[model samples]
Target: MPDASRITPPVVAPTEAPVNPVSMHIRLDPGMPLAHLESVYHAVNTEKNAQGIYQLTLQDAQVPANRDFELLWVPAPGNAPQAALFNEQWQGDEYALLMLMPPAPAPAGATARRVPREVIYVIDTSGSMHGDSIIQARAALKLALERLTTADRFNVIQFNHQTSALFSRAVAATADNLQRALSYVDRLVADGGTEMLPALQLALGQQPEQGVLRQIIFLTDGSVGNEQALFSLIHQQLGDSRLFTVGIGSAPNSFFMTRAAQFGRGTFTYIGKVAEVGEKMAALFSKLETPRLTDIEIHWPQDQPVEMWPARIPDLYLGEPVLVALKLQQPNLPLTLTGDAAGVPWQQQVTLRGGAARSGVHQLWARRKIADLMDQRAQGVAEPEVRKAVLDVALTHRLVSRYTSLVAVDKTPSRPADQGLENKALPTNLPQGWSATKVFGSLPQTATASEWNLLVGLLLLACGVLFSRWPGVGFGVRVGPVSDGKAHGGNVL
Candidate 1:
């Protein structure tokens, strides 16, 4: 795992202090189906014996270079569609979970140790995070400071209905500076309703010119009322800096935390237990140090009929593997690829000629891409015409798709009108779970030449019978059986 300090170079003199790097946040939604979840996380294990409402399980993964981070999420009974958004960071060997469903209590073994970084601990001392919440918040910040080095620069921010900065901008991490910051944190007693928007705006506006990575570690229970307003602002300003969010208590709303990080391109975590702060910090520091692949873009030829999920991929974190699904028109074709690797441009070509006969792999890839397309559609960014085109192809191939399905219909008619004969009546099927809604017309009947011949023969037989019954025609009657002794009963012809 790369230490967070790795991103920042040390300053040689007093005037050359570096800017602290900020964390990024990513949000997740609950309505994610099992297939969608698998696409996000590399590992998903079905418990062999554990039977319950929540059937999926996730195991913690070590951060590996060149791979994406994996996060496992299991739904609670009756969980809503947009329950939570999770953020995670991968160190080389260990993955740091930033958020999850109901935001599970931080691991008992979890801890946050601040790594050497020019740092700023932005605490929301607003009245919203008061009492026990305030106390825990203070402890979390203290724990964070314990990991800093004197080489780092730091400051604090406390916001309520009003906002205040401990120092105008970044402060050196000298003993006096640390003392002043600690004093400010200790003196923080939460009061007043949360007015977080201006505080964040001010915190970000204080960016220093120091070459070090600039960061703002936001501490809050995320209870501010104006979440939408704050989200809009975060979305607007995130590109300027990195922001990490720490949700202080059990009820802390982690949604805002996750959104803030995502917009700011940083990490989001819920700190339910103060004791575990140090370890979590350690994991985070390692991630900050590593840069597996920057500006990753995966591409393939246009004619391959291959669809890649997550058309817009995010940064690859420690330990998480990047999984790409390819739908190939022909299996043996060689595919050209190009992308940036850690700031350097590179290109490679790969052949998909190997044993693709493995059961279910292709199906899995198809399902994943389809799901991704659905997600894009839901976001309202997908082009309807293009999507419809893709859907048609999926239907023709009978591939699993979000919008198309193989539907069964029954065509048995209950009455003469329903027989779907003349009068332009259309045929209607009795779908298992559905009722007929329209009576547009009748069924179309097409007969073969042989069937027509049979119909003509029957018509001729009927005509002959009617002609024989005409008044001028002779009739014969036999009253007795042919073998009868009387043989009598004339046959009058």
Candidate 2:
């Protein structure tokens, strides 16, 4: 019988490399209000033209002439900001990329409800707030108060190294009462270290009663050092009261303020110029009147493997409702959804199949928001397992997360010396644990000292023999074996 080893086939190990998942990061300019939705879509589909304006074409984004997405817009405070939601289900993993379209400009004649709102202006009077920061903050508060309707209720809370409430709780928005509150705001002088945690705690402690649209507008210009602490404090106290944040100064710690507002379920506005305060206040108050749409929710049933970015965050913005796009495993069913608006919910559904996913650019935006949410509070999770799960998903998906960035998962080794050169072609003739760049397509320097000496000796011996055996006619002149002697002086020497 033939030997078993000779008869059996060799097991060839697979050499295929693993594929990396692709993710796209698109930035949405918060400057655009609502009128720019079409422009946003154009920007999404076509390349910007010479003037930086988006050129719209039917072929762009593969949108048909009659194609239109169900538009839901919600107005909010700051810059006439509107939420946009686009619902569609497209097939294929290729379409699972994130797309952040630019926000549109504000539209005309947009209105909100005229409900009673109680707003508390929390001004940071820390010593650091001294100067233009305090001045601008006071002006911004005054401007915001001017925009408030008579039916609204208001109060002022000033905090620095400590917390100070104008009154124990909220007060009615009366002309004389508002004037008295403005007087207190004008007297605010910044002169203490930012112990923002205590101030925030105090503000959150006074929970506004029900049926009142309670909000706290926090203005700051410096780092409090206890940002995470403040976020936790706010999250703990979060219950009906929304915390809007206004970042003052040219270079404030925006990350802290932004996250603070986000955690408090409020809006964030940045003041680039002093003059912007009134406009921002007006825009914010305008949102108070109109019910953009209530009961805002994203409905993607768990029938298939569906992932929505920003799964827990609020809706997307157009000019009315936030723009939301969903990715679906089965698009033929036409995914339908609704957003609750000030107790009024709007329903929308769309069917997607086959090539429809390619046109469903909104789905990419959804994934991106989800990525943002994942990275938002990685440190806050109680369990390392949960944090690791989020981090792993973020790493695998390449989401722009704070906790898990692209470089977070280090495939590279910590110590270069410890890593052996991973050469696929080099044979393992090297000593164990030895790691060096293996020379390829070249012979190794294997000649020992003795061998080298022997080679040189052999070469010298050949040269000496050739020189001695040469036939010479005269000293320093030689005649070859077949030379016809011509009496040439310069003959072979």
Candidate 3:
């Protein structure tokens, strides 16, 4: 036989060197001449608008104009997984992106339900939750209570360093219970460390009432550090309960609260302003009142090699759809989705063919994959394996994960190693009508809360709830502060 290895042609990279990989860190010297400084400022700040530059006439994302939930296949260019061999692209195994847009919410008058419910209201009273966050939480809790019917059973659990419940067990949402619960909520004060695990345990650890929709509406600024511990607890103890997370504040821990809801098999809602509490909470409560779809199953064409994110599919509520990202050997095939919607067997089908490819599908898929990996890490997967896997995906997709970070470094040192650097701290501008940001997550970092920050929170809510809610691929571009002094760089994320 001929030498097979020699017969095959060798694959070569498109370029011998990286085209654009390095991010530069530049600083100006304080001792620079005035003319040089002025020139530098003008050159950096001036935006030379290209006169009538040719722009792509094509629209970016291939989403329908209507709100109807449609199953879509967003294949990569030529079914590719990466762009270039290096830089601004993911060099990894090839796959395609699929999205299942959620159905629009049920009609306002429709969703009158007879099935019973057990609603658990958990609020964070940690010191960081003081001010607007606490007020928002209290108002949200009160609204949820008013929506509860007598047929529903409910309890209120508040936690800081300590955790307490309004009832030893879930009580009927009667006049008396509602009154007492309101009284209990009114006395809550934000003045302790954020101890969330015990509260989660109290909310999810208990057994469910037979034939009742067990739902937990958790309200918090999400200023907690023990995310892994809390996620594990939610995963283990969450037998049949659904969790809905309400992120309360301008810059709450969207990562923690969003993932917590994912693990608890629920959705995330964000209340940015006190004015938004009424509308957003009412919308959420409307969905809560409706019956949720259960026992969902996706049937792909026979014997196709399938690798999908969200290995376990959760039940869907009203306004929530079945969104999935996966890899397939056969891209052009039929797909079937089956589920139980309020005791009714519901199934939908779509033939995989296309109009146009969606933008950033690979990033969306990689994002879901990273979240899945982090879920494994939180569920006690070996640290090294999870880290390596996450790093591969994160680095390949150019995303920020627990395993990867965006860094800025000044390669050239400004002073001698033995010299100490000192400077006066500049005053940070916070958003109007907000207190200082609360430190959150495994590591501590401070961020200024603004209308834009709340917008970020809304975008991070849930993938199933909205196709646009995928984790952002990168950070915002910020223009550095204008100054005559020498510039120094620090890692922002």
Candidate 4:
């Protein structure tokens, strides 16, 4: 196993003040009329896990008190759609709005019979889910299993380095099956690397069950990186299937869960603690039971070409507000919303004029637009086009996108020209309670570069290949400690 101890650098005394300082040369355009500059500094961020909910055992009945806080939610119009407008610094009029769809009464006889659903519950059993995370996951899955009705067929899938299912396929939600699933979930102990692609493939690669609504519920902290591949898979294989995300653990990746749900045309629910699992899962299931407005469309004033995101509107669920970002030439124009709920046509009109004038709406629009471009790039869009478009919006709005970053550039140098810059990388300690096995397949980014005096015991065999055109072909290096008051040396072949 790799060394787990933290390595600290030699402490510098307060009296010593003779060292080489480092600086950068930032070139500025001569044509600029005005430019501002400041010193660049980065404050290190440290995260302390104070949830006090780790290593919880099944027998531990003592639940930790949840830290509560008051929330201030400005309610929007319940009867009509609402909008928030912001005029961007650039040319276009940017705005963001919540396309709230009041529950449309289903058509007569349309809701007489409930549709059977094929629910596939997937839980991540990776090493990151080892403490309270896994416990919360188990609790969420248990509650979800209890909510299954007799008309629904369900299966439980758990994944780490490998994927396993309670049943080979979806089975009827009978008492026997539910009991078996509950047992399987209870026995799950998080202890392996996260290989999420295989699990996603197994869950979504199959054909949807006939005459049943297919829904995939993922309960995980979403620590698996490389979300681009997963998003692409969900986009390609999602055929008439909805995917709901249940974020487990305190530090669950909200971006990943939310985006996965967006691509799967589903909703995202978060369970921060074990105590909140039942209520959150119950709310999610309640939304699933309500009517979903599908085939949503927006009608903007025809005075200018309007850019709206997501380019394709998603289905609306109960009490879930659809946040829409728009770019238009006019701000106060009326826009119409159209959709169908259980074969019943739904329509509402709202103008952005009387809506609250909120700040940062333009930033929201830019961020969503950038995300839309990135989604396209993931779906095989041209790299240059996407980069150029994203860079333009990101720079004009001064927002950080995947392509653009804000770097503080000083007009003057911090050190003398003759002083050579020496950069020393500091070692980063391993995260508390984390295993070195977490980095088995990848290089450790926290490892620092330090001086190593290798003692190559007398050269047993020497071979060297001098490069002509290609320099990194091969090389022979030999060095040893000094002997007899003389330094031992060898060729850098």
User: What TM-score fits each model?
Assistant: 0.47, 0.58, 0.66, 0.68
> Candidate 2 on 1-493: residue-level lDDT in tens?
1122221122112232222222222323322233333331122433444443343333333332111122122222444222233344333442333222323334677444466777878888865455556777888888887877877777788887678888777778788888888888878887744567777777788776678778788888644655556776777787888887887754456767766766776666666446556765666655544435444554445666555654554533323334344455554544445555445545654434422223435435534555454434533665555566666645555555556554446678666786776634322222111112221112233312356688899998888788778886223545544436554444454
Question: Cα deviation in Å at residue 206, candidate 3?
Answer: 0.9
lDDT ranking of the models: 4, 3, 2, 1
Give the residue spans of candidate 3 off by over 4 A.
1-96, 102-108, 319-322, 395-398, 405-493
Error of 1 at 219 (Å): 1.8
In each prediction, how many residue pairs overlap at the backbone (N, C-alpha, C within less than 3 A)? 50, 56, 0, 1
Pick by lDDT: 1 or 4, better one: 4
Reference-based lDDT, each prediction: 0.52, 0.55, 0.65, 0.67
**Per-residue lDDT over 135-205 for candidate 1, one digit per residue giving the tens place of the 0 to 100 score:** 77888787676656776777788887688888887877778878877777788887655667788888766
Top lDDT prediction, candidate number: 4
Better candidate number, 2 or 4, judged by TM-score: 4
Candidate 4, residues 133-234, lDDT tens digits: the string is: 788889888988998889999988899889988888989999999999999888999886677888888889666567888999999878766788889899
> Which candidate, 3 or 4, has the higher lDDT?
4
- Candidate 1: which stretches are off by over 4 Å? 1-118, 302-312, 319-493
**Residue 323 of model 1, lDDT score:** 47
- Residue 211 local lDDT, model 3: 87
Task: Give candidates' CA RMSD values in order.
Answer: 29.7, 25.1, 23.0, 14.4
Candidate 4: which stretches are off by over 4 Å? 1-96, 101-113, 301-303, 409-493
Best model number under TM-score: 4
